[model samples]
Target chain A: GAGVSQSPSNKVTEKGKDVELRCDPISGHTALYWYRQSLGQGLEFLIYFQGNSAPDKSGLPSDRFSAERTGGSVSTLTIQRTQQEDSAVYLCASSILTGEGAFFGQGTRLTVV
Target chain B: AQSVAQPEDQVNVAEGNPLTVKCTYSVSGNPYLFWYVQYPNRGLQFLLKYITGDNLVKGSYGFEAEFNKSQTSFHLKKPSALVSDSALYFCAVSKGPGYSSASKIIFGSGTRLSIRP
Candidate 1:
């Protein structure tokens, strides 16, 4: 697809288990971002990867949450020991640069039970 | 710091009626603001943006927004509302030129727009 693509549109995971969400950004995009959106809430910034620069993890809610962008293309968000509060739609976006507008994926909806 | 706010949580308008969605922002110097919309079970779609040039910016789907520096508001406006326009609207802000900021965008709480038939 020309736009950003995410895998496993929906996931139901058991608590205390681990889950990984994947995102494939648009080709040629140098910047990628991850955000969390709970029900009836706005998007919360998570981590960001820009070229070879260090990612900004300021918005990461906890240590258990981590993400990595391999080869500056594919990105994965991993959550360990899933908790109910961790349930939300994980959104991924990619852009040509920091100044350019981003293209978003449909996002992965994860539910922890 | 940079942030955006949508004062109304929800807005209702009859079909063919004019509609306006209010948005405000606060940032250190100038702001590069944007508006996005989301339909049911979808990610956000970019609508319009206010960068430099003109204060009145036109966007997709017959939607336009006026940037008011004095009021610090960028209200999305449509001449005629359509039933299909019912969805969630978000206002976001980022650091503009001269400021060293990343692609991080701060979104508003989102306003649920309901266009009645």
Candidate 2:
């Protein structure tokens, strides 16, 4: 891909429903990251994946929030029993490697109604 | 812990005038600072970064930022503001590899820069 791509640019789901957001990072990028951005707020770290190493899931806000990256390429963020507080933009980024600048996706705006 | 603060919620600047967006950070060790810009309904774009070397780091779109260790600040600046520059700006900080895991990049609250005609 020319740049990071995210699916379902906008999503409106009822509370308690499950939603899945996808991200396709730039080709050949080794490091991928997931972040959440609320209205008028900063980017919140969610998770990170580096190559074949164990993913860093420390930033997931709660048990309902989970993510997985397959084959070190496409990634999915799944929210189970979503709450109103979960309404926000979910962003994904990829970098050439750790400690480098990251390229971001347009983001998926998930609205829990 | 590493964190960043962008005190101003909004900064108004006249076109062609110099513009500044303030940022401050707290970290356990040497800081790797970054600046990113976001337009309405779009993803954030990397502006510049301060990894090491010179305090003044230049980046795309004629923007630059100064990294000041003593003040614990890395303020984004531009000599002349353009109407197109009006957007949401964010400052982020991460601890150097030795201090913490590389995945954590703590972002500030963000500042909206508006360029007035």
Candidate 3:
């Protein structure tokens, strides 16, 4: 694709419901990152995938937050039993390689009501 | 640990006047700094990066940032401000192998830049 693309630009889900956010990164990018942005808050690192290696899940806030990248191209962020505090924008970015500038997607706005 | 700080929550500048967004960083070793801009309801766009070499590095949309190792700062600067430049600006710092095992870039709280016409 020309740029990073995220699906379901806006999502409103009830508490305890499960939500899935998808991200398709630019072609040939080996490094993918997931970030969460709360109202008036800066980007919070969530996870990172580097060329199909075991993803760095250190930043996942809780056990309910999980993500997976398939074939090193597309990724999905899954939130189980979502809470009101989970309402925020989820952003995805991909870089050609490690230590390079990353290109970001428009992001998915998730509203947990 | 590597972290970034954007001291100003908001900066008001008149169009055609010089604009600056302050940024400071803390890292164990040499710092790889980056500046990004975000408009309303849009994703962040890379403004510039300071990897190595000259202290002054230029980037997209007529933006530039100066890397000052002594001060532990990399402030974004524009000689002449434009209304279109109004947006949220973020400063980020990453720890290279020389510094720490974590290679992820950490962003600051962000500064809102408003250009008054």
Candidate 4:
């Protein structure tokens, strides 16, 4: 793909429901990251995956939040028992390497009601 | 741990005037700083980065940033502000010389830049 891509541009889920957000990183990118942003706020780092190394999950907010990157390409961020506070935009980014600037997707807007 | 901060929540500038968005960071290792801009309903766009080079770094849209190691600040600046330049700006930092699996970009709280005609 020409750029990073995220699916389900907008999602409306009921509280306590599980939602899965997906990200398709740019081809050949060795690094992929997930971040959450509240309306008119800063980005909160969630997870980072680099090549074949174990992912850095220190930023995950809670036990209910989890993510997996399969085949070093596509990633899925799963939020179990979504709460109202989970409503926000989930952003995905990819870079050729860790030190390089990362490209971001338009983001998936999740609304938990 | 590496962390970045944008002290001001918002900045207002007149069109055609110079503008600056402030950022400061802290890190144990070498700091790799970056500036990103986000327009409404859009994704974050990379502005510029300071890895290891001259203090001044130029980026897209005629924007530039200065990396001040002594001050621990990377401030984004533009000579002439345009209405179109109004956006939410973020400052990020990572500890790096390169290719470190443990390194991840840490972002600031963000500052909203508003340019008025």
What is candidate 1's lDDT per residue for A27-113, written digit by digit as tens?
A: 999889998999978889898888888998888999999999999899999999999999999999998865567789999999999
After superposition, the stretches of candidate 3 with alpha carbons farther than 4 Å from their true spots are B97-102
TM-score of each: 0.95, 0.94, 0.94, 0.97
- lDDT by residue for model 2 over B77-102, one digit each (tens)? 99999999999999988776465455
Q: Model 1: per-residue lDDT, tens digit, B24-103?
A: 99987777888899999778999988888899999999999998989989999999999999999998887776777565
Tell me the whole-model lDDT of each prediction, alpha carbons only.
Answer: 0.90, 0.91, 0.90, 0.93
Clashing pairs in 2: none
Cα lDDT over the full model 3: 0.90
**Chain B TM-score, all predictions listed:** 0.96, 0.95, 0.95, 0.96
* Candidate 2: residue B11 Cα off by (Å): 0.9
lDDT of 3 by residue, B1-117 (tens): 678989999999999999999999998888788899999877899988888889999998888999999999999999999999999999988765364343667789999999999
Give the DockQ-based CAPRI class for model 4: high
Q: What local lDDT score does residue A53 receive in model 2, on the 0 to 100 scale?
A: 80
Top model by lDDT, which number? 4
**lDDT tens per residue, model 2, A8-102:** 99999999999999999999998889999999688999998888888989899999999999998999999999999999999999988556778
Off by over 4 Å in 2: B97-101
Q: Docking category for candidate 3? A: medium
Colliding pairs, model 3: none
lDDT of 4 by residue, A1-110 (tens): 99999999999999999999999999999889999999999999999998888999999999999999999999999999999999999999999966688899999999
